[model samples]
Target: MRLSQSLIPTIKEVPSEAQIASHRLMLRAGLVRQTSAGIYAWLPAGLRLLNNIADIVREEQDAAGAQEVLMPTIQPATLWQESGRYEDYGKEMLRIKDRHERDMLYGPTNEEMITDLYRQSVKSYKELPQVAYQIQWKFRDEVRPRFGVMRGREFYMKDAYSFDIDYEGAFVTYRRMMLAYMRTFQRLGVKAIPMVADTGPIGGDLSHEFIILAPTGESQVFYDAAFEDVDYGAANFDSAKPDDLGRFFGIMTDNYAATEEKHDLDVWGKIDDSRKREGRGIEIGHIFYFGTKYSKAMNFAVTGPDGQKLFPEMGSYGIGVSRMAGALIEASHDEAGIIWPDSVAPFKAAILNLKQGDPTTDALCEDLYGKLRKVALYDDRSERAGVKFADADLMGHPWQIIIGPRGAANGLVELKRRATGEREELSLDAALAKIGLNAS
Candidate 1:
């Protein structure tokens, strides 16, 4: 994408309303524009990042055997009523009335709706152990919506529902989702610690809120340093076997990881000082294991193997898909701007034509851009070197390939890694090799 004609309306100064690094950088980088108190319009760069995050979230969920299904943003209020949470959900639920005077709402979460879908179809125990998820937009009118997308009224979410025949099945599903969450965050390039958390509106005794450590996080957290070395990509935990899943779940819960709300100093004291790790953390995702909570209230029943009617155990897992883009910045940014991890960066690299009009620089940039247009963000604007360099850093492409008249003529260009601030002067071929551009 060419910045000369892109919609990335980057600003020189930070907005006063942005309280955190993520919100401030998001505004200055022109990733998103606020339309209202808690509503935002994701610009080109922001949308690309959002989609990238969503794609990875989808991949991990699928890998964990969760089938994808797109759900609607608008839901009928009757579903909530059937679950006895119509009035209990409070004003955060955007209650509405259509022209026909039927009660409805913009769903904050899909627990009730997904449960309703399950009950309508799939009878008998044979359909048990089904997990379905959706990557969709959700809304909850926050009383004080601040901190940009992290606490927004409207946001994208990956909410999945699991239906099982019994508590044992639901527990296994919970761990499967847990494994999926860990891998997802691992790929997203953040060390998200799973902490015991309150289920809140979702309503479940077994719940965990995955929190990523950040200097400017909302809540203080205490965790074990052992969590740092556990590799999700390696060491497979077979979710199919009860014993394997049980062991995985045990390790996660046994670790001394908790937020201020659930912290126990007695438990914290037992851990060795060397193993104790403490920091502020931002909640990235959540998983729950609520057995028969919705199925019982909504009268969702299926026939058991013994021909007896039984309520299917259910659980809900959620990831704040839109909030993740903001969280990534919070977890990984410097004084200049966001330091996007390559796996989720909007663009792979930014090709800077330092002297745009110079024939040598122009030709070199054009050739590089043509070779990498699919993954490169080309800065071809007629701007000063300072302005272009600053904007490139603010956007935080994983790499910046600088081409000047002198360097272009010599078949050499400068390469800078955004995360490490490492710069190398090398031939164009060497620069391409560093960014893994072997073709063309």
Candidate 2:
């Protein structure tokens, strides 16, 4: 993309309302603009990052055997009433009335709606183990929405529902989801620890919150230090048998980890000093096994092998797709701006024509831009060299390739890595070799 005609409206000073580094950087980098108290309009640059994160989430969900589907943002309140949560779910629920005076709501979650959908069509154990997921906007109407997208009232989410005939089957499905979440975070260049968590309004007996340690995070967490080094990707889950799933579950559960709401002082004291670690963490994803909570309430039943009708055991998994943008910035930013992970950076590299008007520099940048269409951003703006360099850093592309008259004359250009702040002078061919077609 060429910055000369792009819609990135970057600013020089931080907004007073932004309280954290990620929030400030997001504003200054022109990634998003606030539409209301907690609602935002994602600009071109931010939307690119959002789509990348959603792609990762979809890939992981598909690998775990979940099929993707789209659900409506506005749902009839009758479903919530059927689940006996219409009165239970408090003010956060954005209740409304339609022309016929029927109760309607902007869904905060989709348990009730998904249960109603399943009950209407699925009638037997033949479809016993099915998982459906959707990526859509959700609203909670937070009383004090703040911290940008991190705690926004309106945000995007990836929510999946799993249905099984019995408790044992449901547990296996839950384990698959847990492993998938771990791998998803790892691929996004973040280490997220799974900690036992309170389900809150989403009632359930079993729940786990995937959290990443950050000093400015809202949740306090305690865990074994060994969790920091565990590699979920290396675990052989793809070819594992049913029994192997049980073993993997046991190995992960044997470790100690919990959020402050579920933390136990006795368990913390039992661990050796070297193994104990406490820190603040941001909650990025959550999974829960709610047995027949939604199915029974909404009359979602399937016939068992013995010819008896039974409510299907069910579970839900959620990832805050929009909130992850803020979480990533919180975990990986420096004084200059966000240090985006290469996997999710909007552009792999920014090709800055330091002397834009110079014929040699222009020709070199244009050539490089044409050759690397998929992974390059050509900065052809008529801005000062210093301004262009600062904007490139603030935008957080993984690399910056600078071309100037002097460098072009000498058959050399500069390549700089955003994360490490390392630079190298190399020939045009060598520079392209260093950052291949799919470098990001």
Candidate 3:
């Protein structure tokens, strides 16, 4: 993509309303714009990152045997009433009325609606273990939405609903999701620790909140330091039998980890000082096993092996897809701007034309840009060298390749890594190779 031809509306000064670094940087970098108090319109650059994150979530969900489905944003309130949660969900639910005066709402979550869907078609044990997921927009009228997308009233989320015949089946499904979440976060370059959490309005005894530690995070969390080094990918879930999965679950559950809402001072104090660690963390993902909560209320029943009708056990898993954009910025950024992870960066590298009018520099940048179509952003704008340098850093591409008349004359280009602030002078082919692109 060429900067001169793109719609990147970067600003020089931070917006006064942005209170956090990620919020400010996002505004200054032209990633997003606030349309209302907590609603935002994602610009082209921000949309690229959002799509990348959603793709990762989708991949992991599919790998875990979940089918993708789209659900409506506006749903009839009758569904919530059927589940007995219409009055219990409280004010955050955006209640509305259609022209005919029917109660309606923009769904804050989809438990009630998904239950109704399952009950309508899935009537037997043949479809006992099935998971359906969707990536869609959700709205919750947060009284005070702040921290940019991290706490936005309108945001994108990936929610998956699982149905099973009984507790044992539910456990199997939950373990599959746990393994999936680990892979999802790992692929996105985040170390998310799963801590026991209060289920809150969702109402469940078994729940885990995946948190990423950041200084600006909202909740306090406690866990063993050893969890920081544990890699879920090392455990092969694809080949693991039921017994192997049970053992994996035992290993994860045996560890001590809990959010502040569920923390026990006495139990936490039992751990040695070296093993204990406390920090502020952002909740990026949450999973819960609410057995028969929605199914029973909505009459979602299936025949058991013994020929008895039973309400299927249910569970829900959620990952904050839009909020992860801000969370990624919060967890990884420097004074200059965001330091995007390679997997989600909008562009792998920015090709800076230090002297746009110079024939040599122009030719070099154009050649490199043509060779690397999707992986590079060519800065062909007629701006000063310093201005281009600053914009490249602020945009947070993983690498920046600077070409000038002097460098081009000497058969060299300046290559810089955004995260490490390291620069090197190398031949054009050498620089492209270093950025993991084939110059040929």
Candidate 4:
């Protein structure tokens, strides 16, 4: 993508309304624009970043045997009414009336709707365990929505529901989802610690909130450093195996981790002093094992093996897809701008043409750009070297391929890593190799 041809409307001055680093950086870097209070229109670059995050979530869910399904943003109020939560959900539920004067709402969550879907088609213990998921937009009428996408009124979310025949089966699904969430967060280039959490309105006795540590995060958290040692890719546990999940679950819960609301000093005091980890954290994902809360309330049931009617135990898992964009920025940014994780960066690298039209410089950049055009953002604009540099840093591509006339003429390019501010001059082939490209 050429800068001159793209629609990135970067700003030099920070908007006064943006109170957080992610909010200010998002606007200044031209990732998104506010269309209304607590609502935003994601620009091309922002959309790419969002898609990348969603893709990771989808891949992990599929690996965990969760089938993807698209649910409607607008839901019938009857679903909530049947679940006995219509009046209980409060103002956050955007209740409305359609042309026929039927009560409807913009869904904040899909528990009731998913329960209705489950009971409609799934009829016996033969299909006991079914995990369905969707990545879609959700709306909640927050009274004071702020902090950019962090607390947005309308945002993208990935919600999954698991249906099982009994408590034992549901607990297994919950552990499996926990493992999936850990893998998902690690892949998204963030370490999220799972802490015991309240179920709140979702009504679950067992719940866990996945939080990523950041100075600007809303909740103060304390945990053991043992969480930092587990490598998701190398962790030898199978999501499909019950015993493996049980072992994994034990490992996760054995560690003392909690938000301020759930913090227990007695437990915290027992941890080794060297292993203590404490910081403010942002909640990126949550999982709940509500058993028969929705199924019982909505009177959804299937025939058991003994030919008796049985309410299927269920669990809910959610990840804030759009809010992750802000969370990622909050967790990983420097004074210059956002330091995007390589996995979710809009572009792999920026091709900054220090001398845009210089014959030698342009030749080198075009050659590199042509080879990596699919993954590269070419700064083809007729802007000053300093201006190009500033914008490149602001956008926070993982790498910057700087091609000045002096370096280009000598068949060399300066490669810089965004996170470390490290730069090196190398041959064109070496530069490409360093960026994980091979000369074909």
lDDT of 2 by residue, 146-213 (tens): 99999999999999999999898998899899988888898888878898877889998999999987
- How displaced is residue 348 in candidate 4, in Å? 0.7
Top candidate (lDDT):
4
Against the hidden true structure, what lDDT does model 1 obtain? Answer: 0.90
**What's the residue-level lDDT of 381 in candidate 3?**
95
CA lDDT, candidate 2, residue 411 = 80
Error of 1 at 147 (Å): 0.8
Residue 286 local lDDT, model 2 = 94
Candidate 3 local lDDT, residue 274: 96
Off by over 4 Å in 2: 240-248, 438-440
Pairs with backbone N, CA or C atoms under 3 Å apart (clashes), candidate 3: none
Which tens-of-lDDT digit does each residue in 184-290 have in candidate 4? Answer: 89999998899999888999799999999888899899999888867766444443555755555776788899999999999889888999999999999999999
- Give per-model TM-scores: 0.97, 0.96, 0.96, 0.97
| Clashing residue pairs in candidate 2 (N, C-alpha, C atoms within 3 angstroms) | none
Model 3: per-residue Cα lDDT over 1-440, one tens digit each = 89999888899998899999889989999899999999999998999999999999999899889999999999999999998889999999999999999999999999998898888889789877999999999999999999899889999999999999889999889988987898898889887888887788888789988998877778888888767666666666677466756555665577788878888999998999999988888899999999999888888889888889999999999999999999989889888888999999989999999998899888888888999868888999999999998998898999999999999888899999999999999998888778788968
Candidate 1 is scored at a TM of: 0.97
Model 4 RMSD to the real structure? 1.4
Off by over 4 Å in 3: 242-251
Cα deviation at 419, candidate 1, in Å, is: 1.2
lDDT of all the models against the reference?
Answer: 0.90, 0.89, 0.89, 0.91
